[model samples]
Target chain A: MSEGKGGGETVELLLPATPERLALARTTGAAIASRWRFTYDEIADLRLAIDELCLTLIRPAQQEGEPRRLTLAYTLDGSSMVVRGQVDKPNPAAVNGDGQAPQPTSVSDLSERILDALVDEHGSERTDSQLSAWLRKGRSVAAP
Target chain B: MEEVFEIAEYSDDSTPVLSVRGEIDVSTAPELRDRLLGVAQDGYSTVVVDLSEVTFLDSTALGVLVSGLKRFRSAGGDLRLVVTGRNVTKVLEITGLVEVFPIFDSVSEAVST
Candidate 1:
């Protein structure tokens, strides 16, 4: 765990990039969100956001038959939480022989709309050797 | 570790009801898809998915439900939902699925309508 600038806590998790493990990610997010005093609805949104981010990174790895791992960092400050995740680089052998970089995995339209509505900010970045996604949600003042 | 996800099939009078419990994510969505496909293939025109016991749902599960809805509608039937959980309702609302699927508060209401 790391300390945020606001003296908040940040938890890091590394797990196998498999669908079965998605629940663990969601559970961890929910637990932290609850501790931060997020509302029930806010916690639910965080859970779904974390699940969607992890699954987006895991799909390409599964299709490639590579046993990749996913790393997630959940950072909670005074009024908001940010969750970020990255998948391990794929096998060099799996790279296209034409020296072209693989396209970043695309989220479905439904996933896009859900993420847009749930998080205050979210996006993904892809480099030749790395792919990552992140989302930030703020606690509503009405939350207890 | 895999989460506990269950789907039970029973009849609400003459209509088929799939009662699902637990979290539905990427891993468990295939099971849901297969069961829904099974219902569609069995020649059932209308089916009700009881999600009152469901705790969570992600886009993968939503995609499966949308596909199931399409399959049922294409067969000249319909797929309805019985939703109770806040999380599930929020998801459906987020995706504009509340307008697509006939939603009810109870299984009996879903079957009766």
Candidate 2:
């Protein structure tokens, strides 16, 4: 299948939810965004946004050897790119550290706002056994 | 494989400083965290992080820095950063942390301040 120059393509990655492997996800996301003709600044934003999403998925349990796997599904739709991230956890809200969530002004909430600023639009939802976040950024005219 | 990140420590006017190169991401943040914490634990009144050579800086790394900053401030010292990369600066701006830290354009400026 030819994705064509600046054509749309979808890339999916599944990796352990370990910090050591998080770099792989960031690099892959940036590479795919670059292929889609995103600008350097756009690619940088995509990398950091994806990094924040992945960090949100990290659980202290991960350090105990019951490593979880994160599935990142990224789609480049010609004019824009969208990255959907999911993990094994059922409730995305459950990923919230403690029942008492951080205030919108708290430092813990700062990362989420950073992701919000980096991407054109972002959202997250949870399912029976999966927690997912979707990040989107438009392609630049210079991309070919 | 070249280290994803490298840290070099030095003293500028007797103020401890960390010269960090490469990407500051999840894979390498812990090392940075440990080193910064160590500096604080050792009772450095003030410290500067030179991130001019950092190619990428992520939220995890920022969290570590903020944690370190808080640690230092509570001890009556302060943590400062020298950031030059657009990528690093962009994140700092977006997070509103650009106002929180004393950011300098050069190591000398950060150290002198």
Candidate 3:
């Protein structure tokens, strides 16, 4: 869990990068998004987005072998929340030497369309050692 | 963890209906795919997936449904969806799948059409 440097709240979770653990990730993200005053529709979008993002990391990590795990960080700042996820053991083939943000290879076209409609911003980052994906959503003004 | 997924199959006249409850993600999508395949193999010409009780579904589930639809359609059959929940309908809309699959508000409506 990474601590928030400012006054914003950040929650971090670590779970095995398996399909069975996806529900826990979605539930946790929904709880945090609810607390941050996101609308019902917004929460639903976040839940789906989190599921897609986690699965995007999990599928490749699962093929690589043991100790498959995912680290998720949810940071609530002002009217928006940012969720960042990284596989503990990244696929060797996915690591980049140029320190550029590499696209996640496992995201299906359906996942791409869903994320495009749900989140404000999303992308993946890969360095020499690790790969991560993140999404940010701003609370809808229609919420009371 | 307790079970958060369930799928039951039955018939409305000659058409088959798969009533699903709880979330459908990667973990539970295989079960769905299997059942859809089972229906197709059993020679059902039309099938309805009743997702009115479904609370959540991801792209994996969508892919499964799309595959099932393709299988049925290839054989001169069709796949229909019954989605009453806003979230589920919103997902179908987001992916523009609402235009792809025949969607209804209830099982009866889907089975009828």
lDDT of 1 at B36: 93
TM-score of chain A of each: 0.83, 0.78, 0.84
Interface RMSD of each: 2.4, 2.3, 2.3
Clashing pairs in 3: none
Instruction: Write one digit per residue (lDDT tens) for candidate 1, span A1-144.
Output: 889667879999999988888889889999988988888878888889888878667877777887888999899866889888888786554444553224333236777788899999988766577667888999996435
- In candidate 1, clashing pairs total 0
Q: In TM-score terms, which candidate is top?
A: 3
Model 3 residue A15 lDDT?
89
Residue B95 accuracy (lDDT) in model 2: 84
Per-model TM against the reference: 0.89, 0.86, 0.90
User: Which whole-number lDDT from 0 to 100 does residue B73 have in model 1?
Assistant: 92
In candidate 3, position B56 carries an lDDT of: 90
| Residue B39 local lDDT, model 3 | 93
Deviating ranges (above 4 Å) for candidate 2: A1-8, A60-65, A89-107, A142-144, B1-3
- Candidate 2, after superposition: displacement of residue B65 in Å? 1.2
lDDT of each: 0.84, 0.78, 0.84
Give the residue spans of candidate 3 off by over 4 A: A1-3, A94-107, A141-144, B1-3
True contacts kept of 3: 0.72
Per-residue lDDT of candidate 3, residues B20-45 (tens digit)? 99989999999999999899889887
